[model samples]
Target: MKTVLKYLPALTLAAGLALSAIPAMAQQPAAKAGAAPAQPKSSPAAIAAAKEILSMKNASAMYANAVPGMVEKTKIALIQQNLNYQKDLNEVAQVVAQQLNGRQNEITEGMAQVYASEFTEQELKDLVAFYKSPLGQKLITAEPKAIGLSMAFMNSWAQNFTETVMGAFRAEMRKRGKEI
Candidate 1:
């Protein structure tokens, strides 16, 4: 238990760094204009905002927020506390996985909406071309794994950290004859 606790922070940080690195793949490059310099289809500001909102960071944060409720739900379904910990953990993992999958869908859908509003058909074609390149495909593959690993690491870290902190606090309260 202590060994796991000791390495939790390192694992969490590594997972976070890995996840943070995954999303650069899908980022659209600067739009190139053809001979006519096609009147810059989308406002640069709107494009920037859409990119920011649809970014991996934003998606990961949303996933992170959804995980605790999942964990709690698992805990509440106790059959036998000791025997069920692993089972509960597995269930929570599934929940997080599903949430990440949904988030990726959301990001894709949001991008489609933005493209519809911001770009003409030709400009959308140009954007799709860039995303279909090798770099774009790599990003698409990596982002989900990054998200999953990061969430798993953080969930473990949070559970352990909460246990540690709450254990100490409860001990202190017990010493003071206070009900926790």
Candidate 2:
């Protein structure tokens, strides 16, 4: 469960990227430390188009549980810091979750901002048009399953490789008169 929790943000980001032309957009090299490029200024039209594309992909649904999960994580951390406040922390978590309900749209909006900044208004318009087409619609339906299968395969491969690496480590350590 803890592992699953830790990977939730990655999964959410992956899901969003999987739904967009992120691979192409990611071609540029990352910036050096403290030298990140500024986000391009997005026009309202560009933002709107980005929002439409995101809506077609149902992006907000991916983060539907985020608010509640964050509240719970914070509550647990607070409880850990002051065990005597566990009950109050739990109550506060519920209140915070309630207050933040439906705020998952914030994630959707932020993603739209990223898309809008990365692509021109015309490009975003083109994306919306593409999503409206039959082939694009088919991709929208198929991509999630493809991503699921890919993740499963990668997990299986990594698990099998883990033992191989562990054995190699042990062998190398034994040769050095040290056991690991």
Candidate 3:
């Protein structure tokens, strides 16, 4: 518990940094004034696929599960402590969300630049509409969970892969009478 508490701030900071680094669609520059926004040429199937992929139920559930662990690790004692804990967590979450949203905007803007030549204005409008729907809203709201899960999965995989590669390297070095 104490160890978890000791690392909480570091972990939170790392998470914030990681979230802020993601590329989003909104970060791209707009076209010349009076020029139309470029949109992706997407079919109904494609739109449906995007909507399905962005489901927030799973993300919300995962967030609900993980938040309690974080709160517990923080070790708040009373109503005031709990309130403070909530406030701090909410503040940090908002910051991370903004960073991630900025990144998303950047990516979208870049995509717009690329697909501008390929897609029509209406297609872009449709894509934006889909993104602004209730489902889209849910996905945006639940982004933190998705980010957290992805980070955890990647970190675990990288750790295991590094250990395996390093272990093999050390073993080979030892066999060759070299310092590992």
Candidate 4:
């Protein structure tokens, strides 16, 4: 009986550790099953048409332009701490610009594949024609402003939704004798 009592605490600790590990173990099969195979490369002609459409749309420039603002926002705390932040930020921006430029081809190629797969060759040609027209050109120019407005609206909506949902969650947790 004395020996059994001595080992009982160790057995309980081992059981607690095993129970803590169950969530991690449960995730392994889902990860293996959910991975998809790599897609084959797009054809050269399709790649060319996609490139033309992407250039007309100026997609890469839009993506690259967004990075600097995002990076600056992320570094706000560091900027507050240092007086030489302008110089540091400029250098970091250059490096980030270089990296974006370096990856531009890969990004463009991926986008081209999406275009190629989704649209027929004739459709892509028609799109190129449209983009070359005055209306399409206007759309290209106006898109950034439209996107900015859309994002602002969505952000306001998300904040309100998150607050409402979290308030309910806290209430439920409190009812269960747990506060989060």
Residues 43-91, candidate 3: write the lDDT tens digits: 6554443333223222222233334444444434433466756767666
- Ranking 2 against 3 by TM-score, winner: 2
Displacement of the residue 177 alpha carbon in candidate 4, Å: 8.9
**What TM-score would candidate 3 get against the native?**
0.35
TM for every model, in the order presented, reads 0.33, 0.77, 0.35, 0.48
lDDT of 3: 0.50
TM-score of candidate 4 to 2 decimals:
0.48
In candidate 2, what are the lDDT values of residues 7-122, reduced to their tens digit?
54456447756655566558767778899678878999999999998788777666778889888888888999999988888888888999989887788889889888778899
Regions of model 3 farther than 4 Å from truth: 1-118
Query: Candidate 4, 8: how far from true, in Å?
Result: 60
Name model 4 segments beyond 4 Å from true: 1-44, 62-103, 169-180
- Using lDDT as the measure, name the better of candidate 3 and candidate 4: 4
10 residues in a row with least lDDT, candidate 4: 8-17
Best by TM-score: 2
lDDT of 1 by residue, 1-180 (tens): 455444444344345445433543235455556643233446554555445434522343443434455555655555346564777666766676566544444544555454444444555455445556787656555655555565668789999999999999999999999969
lDDT of each: 0.53, 0.80, 0.50, 0.64
State which candidate, 1 or 4, has the greater lDDT.
Answer: 4
Which pairs in model 2 have colliding backbones? none
**Candidate 4 local lDDT, 1-180, one digit each (tens):** 344333333333334335534654565444346676334556677778878977766556545544555566656656677757767876776687566555545766776786665555676677788878999888666754555555567668999999999999999999999989
